[model samples]
Target: MPLFEYRCMKCNHDFEELVAATGRTKVVCPNCGATSVEKLHSVFAARADASPIPVPAGGGCGRCGDPAGPCGM
Candidate 1:
């Protein structure tokens, strides 16, 4: 099962749902009972055992000599 986020256009309510593969396309908003619910992409948190990742900023760090922060140049 996967969790998906949905926002209702009619009532402007946001909610999440745990659904199977077949139920992903046919979800309805529970708050407003409207079929105009828009499904949103779900974001998952990184696991504890995951590798240390580099930050994705454009500039480099001036204080630490690292690419973690923005370089003023």
Candidate 2:
């Protein structure tokens, strides 16, 4: 099962759901019971086990440094 993020267009409520991939498209807003909920594409940082990888401080792009931009990349 994959966790999916959903946003309600009617109530503007955000929530997460754990559902089978086949059922993902059938999910509706739980708060407002509306079918106008949209599945959101989420960005997740890679993790090792339960530990989060440390990011270098000082606003530098640890991956590719060429003067940091607004996105820190």
The candidate that wins on lDDT is 1
Clashes of each: 0, 0
Over 1-73, each residue of candidate 1 has an lDDT whose tens digit, in order, gives 7777889989989988777876436677888789888777663422322533334456565545576564433
Best by TM-score: 1
Judge candidate 1 at residue 26 and give its lDDT: 69
TM-score of 1: 0.54
Q: List candidate 2 stretches off by more than 4 Å.
A: 23-25, 43-73
Clashes of 2: 0
lDDT of each: 0.67, 0.65
Which lDDT tens digits does candidate 2 get at residues 1-73?
6676789999999988776756435778889899888777542322333454335676554456534523332
